[model samples]
Target chain A: GAGVSQSPSNKVTEKGKDVELRCDPISGHTALYWYRQRLGQGLEFLIYFQGNSAPDKSGLPSDRFSAERTGESVSTLTIQRTQQEDSAVYLCASSLTGAAANNQPQHFGDGTRLSIL
Target chain B: LAKTTQPISMDSYEGQEVNITCSHNNIATNDYITWYQQFPSQGPRFIIQGYKTKVTNEVASLFIPADRKSSTLSLPRVSLSDTAVYYCLVGVGLNDYKLSFGAGTTVTVRA
Candidate 1:
């Protein structure tokens, strides 16, 4: 894709249900990231992937929040047993490589607005 | 992660220059300052970054002082389309790309 792409721009799910958000990073970009933004709040880092290295999941809020990246292209963020508090916009970004990659700036997607009722 | 503090909101007018300042008292020596802009319903886009002194790009300019405890983002000739949330962040500039965004300064550019 020309830029980062996210699937299901919006998602409404019931409590206790599961949801998956997908992201397709720009071609040739070796770094990918996921973030969560609550209403009127700043973005919270969730995870990051650099090439074939193990993903850095230190920012995942809880056990219910998990993510996986396939190779260096597509990634998925899954939320288990959705709760009302989980409603927010999930954003995805990709850069040429992880930080200090010649000051490579991250490009973000439109994001998926997930709502749990 | 270095903790950053910025205004909750700001108001500006078209054709005027807007400057948003951020303070990071505990920033590490190896950290670099970066800024991002985000419109409603869209993801953040990187604007400018700098280590010290001044760095300017076509979209924005970043000014950092000698102390490195604070930095400023300057937007010249603002337009309504420039209305968006601006975020300032400090990172190690190392291989780790994890970002922790504080409550951004929402800039409302009116016509």
Candidate 2:
């Protein structure tokens, strides 16, 4: 792909229902990140992956939130038993290399607008 | 990551230059200053990054002082399309690169 890609641009579900958000990084990009932006709030980092290394999950809000990536291709973020507070834009970004963060500019997708009813 | 502070919003006119300054009092020596611009319903895009002094690109310029405590993002010849929220970020490293965005400075470029 020319840039990072995310699936299901918009997802609306009832409370307690689980949802899966997918992300496809740019070709050969070694770093992928997931973030969320709640209404009227700043972006909150969820997690990050550098190649095949164990992802950094310190930013995950709760045990209900988990993510995984295979090699360096695609990533998935799953929210179990979603809550009303989970409503926000789920953003995915990828960089050329995660080894040097400042040198690599992340390219973001359009993001999935998750609405919990 | 170093904490950053910026104005809530600002208004500018077309053909004028717009400058948004961000302050990071606890910036570390290894940290680099970076700026991003985001439009409504879209994700943020990198504008520029600088370690010290000045760095310029086709999109914008980042000016950092000797103290490295603050930096400014200068947008030249602004237009209506330049209206967006600008974010200033620091502490971009390989080990801990999680970016924490502030309220951001909303620049409204009017015709």
lDDT of 2 by residue, A1-117 (tens): 598889989999999999999999899999889999887777788898888554578889999999999967889999999999999999998888894756676778989999999
Stretches of model 2 off by over 4 angstroms after superposition:
A99-102
DockQ measured for candidate 1? 0.50
User: Which regions of candidate 1 deviate over 4 angstroms?
Assistant: A99-102
lDDT of each: 0.87, 0.88
In candidate 2, position A114 carries an lDDT of 99
Individual DockQ of the candidates? 0.50, 0.56
lDDT of 1 by residue, B11-92 (tens): 9999999999999999887787889888888888878888899999899888899999999999999999999989888873
Best by TM-score: 2
Candidate 2 chain B has its poorest 10 consecutive residues by lDDT at B91-100
- lDDT, model 1: 0.87
